[model samples]
Target: MSRPQHFGWFLARGFGPQGWGYPSLDWDYDWTRPEIYQEAARTLEQAGFDLVIIEDAPSLGSADTIDLRVRHAFGGPKHDPLLLAPYLFQATRHLGVVPTVNPAAYLPYTAARQFSTLQHLSGHRLGLNVVTDTGSARHFSDSAQLGHDAAYDRAEEWLTGIRSLWRSWEEGTLVRDPDTGVFADGSKLQPVRHRGAHFAFDGPLNAIPFTDGEPAIVSPGGSGRGLGFAGAHSDVQLALAPLDEASVRAYRAKIQDAAIAAGRSPADIKILFAIQPVITSSAEEADRIVAASAHPDDAALVQIARKQSSDLETDLTSLDLDRPLDITIFGDHVSRGSIQRLIGDRGEDVPLRAHLTALARTGRITDRSGFVGTAEELADLIEELGDWGNDGVLLWGDFHPVTLHRTLDELVPVLRRRGILRREYDEGGLQANLRAF
Candidate 1:
């Protein structure tokens, strides 16, 4: 009613680790050191974080690829996100655990059962992040990644099947009737014999459906097809928008429009932007931390920019920071298609190198749109974000555990005191907490 709490919580792995920072080999982490996942879960639990996102990627990209190698420590080794979930859930009573899973890699029947089992175990503190493949289906030697629109079609079918499995046995369907030695009432159990172009599954899942029901779906698809798929099925559409105000507003408009076109409530979809908060007792100290943590390598900077804007291919050394960027050098590899389209529309003729450097500088230093200040100042920045139509921030870690802790300990309380954030968590899973909001 009072603008239903706008922001929600989400965290990822590798954000804040005591063991490693940029330029260090990612695998070099002292595994013996306290794991970031555990620490972050505890931190979020104490801070009333609504959800933690467990990223799903089969293997790290090779160090040669610009996008993956730099930010991820030149192709870092990893742990299974799902494997970390139970501990995370157990460690934190109220936080939701959203694990990213590529449906193409695993069968729906198997995934449905696994999610259902987890929901039962975690007391419905589970959620799914459905990501269709990026481009190629090389991840699957058996089957190719579904085509653009087709992938969503498959996702819709896949979601339907999963829900069917969850709802197969209604309440009181399994009656312990001893009079005639009949153990159950079989009428409510419906076999979900779902068969489609991309997937096929028969009957109910192996596991008993959770008394709390199936996990809600969160989709991060901003691609046209992906957005449509999310609008049709997802409980929360996790969106990543640029730092610029115009960019953020435009993306919000587009996603909400897509949601409306799909006959879904635009309010049901929440927009989340990546934030790297560097907080200190004073604004100047926060700035110093940001400056100290800057990624010195220009190549790495260019690579990071390339991830969001795929078109820029200029060497960072050649850029003049004070000028607008030119577009012709991008040639064919247009990045994050939507952002590129925006740039193309603007028709600014600055050098490509300058453009990349500017983007790199922004991303490297102020992940939170330069929200470095005292707790009160940081709260002001978050409230500003809210005023602009965004629901919340998805914080990215700058150096390691310190960055995450600083925000939670210093800034989160400020927001809570302002009547913007929850003072105490509602008792339940991620979906329950969100629905309450």
Candidate 2:
């Protein structure tokens, strides 16, 4: 893998409690602080990151949530991601800003217009992470939250309509035909009338066509419905699993297969894994920071695991953390077993105790391992993952944006020196960045 490969910055106000792969912050940090986000964005731009993926969650499920609950108590100074787009766009010249949006919450026409406007404002630097509401029904009106497959079905139509509206006008469609005294070419614009199972659209969008086409589509989901959509349209496919070689390989293979099945080249979609790095001048210092950091409570760990586990009913929190993890605990959730297989494939032949500790040390080590080291050491580890089975990495931020900030300042340059990271922004827009792969 060379400098042209994908390396994106991941954000979630990591500085607070529940930092990446660890517990949240002590006192909840003020996420709305402009200086906070600005510093983070500046770091990534300096480091030559391909994009900044800012995630959005509607709400925490509930109070008294178990440990590892992604729903936090009081996330700070939050604002709509769309409103923040220009802030990040203005902060960096080339870093793509990908913000997730749910089609269910807003009309497709409105979203199309917003993103098209964003495309013009950002100079085509925006990317879209299309989501079809994997959340609970309570988040929407009684009529909105449809079944899973139905949601995707509706999404397909929504995307189709959005695309049509984007091409509604061609470049130079607005002609200064002063001879005819015409302000625009009317024939070049067309309305998209779509009537699908879940949605119906019949009007032309309010904004002009974005010549670059809709921002590069990214899908974080990989379930049957998700893979089908992503394989057909997504430029980047986000995967979350333990950071182990086998896990990385298996996930990538599945996504490729999905892409191939969708009648698109498997290489069209890049697989991105979340990785949080702790960097220092020396590898030992990085190791010390990781070692010194406290793991979130056992309950939190189990709850986090439960979210991805197919067998959500099984409560792993009650089990003794000291006890050797019984594979039987994953009974019925074949996916959980698949996760365990990844750890076992690592070629370690230690006793059950050591294996258990290895599993516990990483908190349900499905396959991925965190890299804690100096910049050079971290870059080497990234190279190792690239060799193993990673297209690129999504650097997870802990403590607001501090983890990402440090990475851009310290680690990225090391990778660049080794010819593993880009020295300058790739020419063109967000879609161009993803298409370069």
Candidate 3:
């Protein structure tokens, strides 16, 4: 028997427009209002998902890149996901709402107070996907402008300050005596002052302390510094790697090593691999999708190019199909990982068309490496992960009801019947839900 695995949804499109490029936007739900997301949140809870992670990129880059970011709605024009969390909390009782939050965007003092209030408000289901993005530092006048690893340095300091603020009130400090009408012991409030290399703050936050644990911390970085930060502080590591049994076990060991170095047990952090599987109704449909990808025409290649253009911060639509791509076209800030991911195994010497064509080629799920598959096939991969002692998966998609149901409608029942998906949410909210397994 396979042990159950935790599951979450990654709202890759953020709190902005949902299904902008897809035909499902015609579903006619207003993305601006809260109703669409609320409906999605309720659907996720019913499906036994533990959480939904909202992805956000707070900047549109320089004047040259604004069109690339917003023209296709790939990166920018997103509202604050932190603000959207409350509406999600209102819609569901158990699903954890982890909104992307940048240390560069929010002051430590302010973030702590706001996060603390939300944690208590939601009964501790609130979580912060702490990001160390330095591109948007200009938006906040006081924000530090740091380099790659330095950003992690500041985030470490920032997280330290936030936790200091969270623990301002001593344990047993809040004593509610109805007879005396005393809600808290003023004497138990500890002095909270943080003076660090990146941040300085004084706190004894006005927000009440949580009776359960504090809001969970999540990190999505894959670098050495990123892994260290996750090991030291995060309750959830939004991990990414190949999903093979060997790769999964190796990745788990790396995280365990990092945790051990941080004086924490390997189990202190849950490793939820980020997966985006293409689910199909049957083996025939899955094969059809893969077959269509083998030789994508100009129109299909252009569609893939359009999506890549938005992410790379450079347009690929105009590039000559038969000629090699000029590496110079990408800006300094574009993630090399994203560009490499686009090109995949195809070398840089190859023509732009070859790279795009390789991307368009889809493989069968029976390969255990590619994503296209039926619900039963997807479950097989998931069960294999559990058998390897892997934690779970975080499914990536738009936070819209249509996209969600289309993916989960067939998948959830199969997982539940296999005894993999959670049957009921554990008590004490998100943190408890995570540790429950």
Which portions of model 3 show Cα errors greater than 4 Å?
A: 142-144, 325-332, 345-347
Residue 378 of candidate 3: its Cα lDDT?
93
- Cα lDDT tens digits, model 2, 1-437, are 34445888766542233343343344345456445566667777777778877766553432323332443322322356767778888877888888877777667778788888899888788888777654434566666446667777777777777887787776777776889998787777776687776667776666776656468777776467777788777888877766667767877888888778878888788888777665666645655555544455545455444443322233444555555555554423123334443346544333333333344453111112455666666677677777775778888764255455556667766687777777766566777777665
lDDT of 1 at 362: 29
Clashes per model (N, Cα, C within 3 A): 6, 19, 0
Instruction: Please rank every candidate by TM-score, starting with the best.
Output: 3, 1, 2
Off by over 4 Å in 1: 1-19, 22-35, 62-75, 145-147, 176-183, 242-250, 285-352, 363-369, 387-390, 398-400
Q: What is the alpha-carbon lDDT of model 1 when measured against the actual structure?
A: 0.61
Residue lDDT tens for model 1, 1-437: 11324343454433333345444425355532435566667777677667767554554432234344335342234445666678777777777888777766667778777887788778888888886643325556655445656666766777777788777777777777788787667777787788787777787656665654358788875677777777667777777665567878888887788778889888777666666555567656766755654543656655545443321223333445446655454433223343453353345775444444444442222345455556776666667667787677666542244546656776666777776676576655666677665
Worst 10 residues of 1 by lDDT: 308-317
lDDT against the true structure, each candidate: 0.61, 0.64, 0.86
TM-score for candidate 3, residues paired by index: 0.95
Q: Cα RMSDs of all predictions?
A: 5.2, 5.8, 1.9
TM-score of each: 0.78, 0.76, 0.95
Report the C-alpha displacement of residue 49, candidate 1, in angstroms.
0.8
Indicate which candidate wins on TM-score. 3
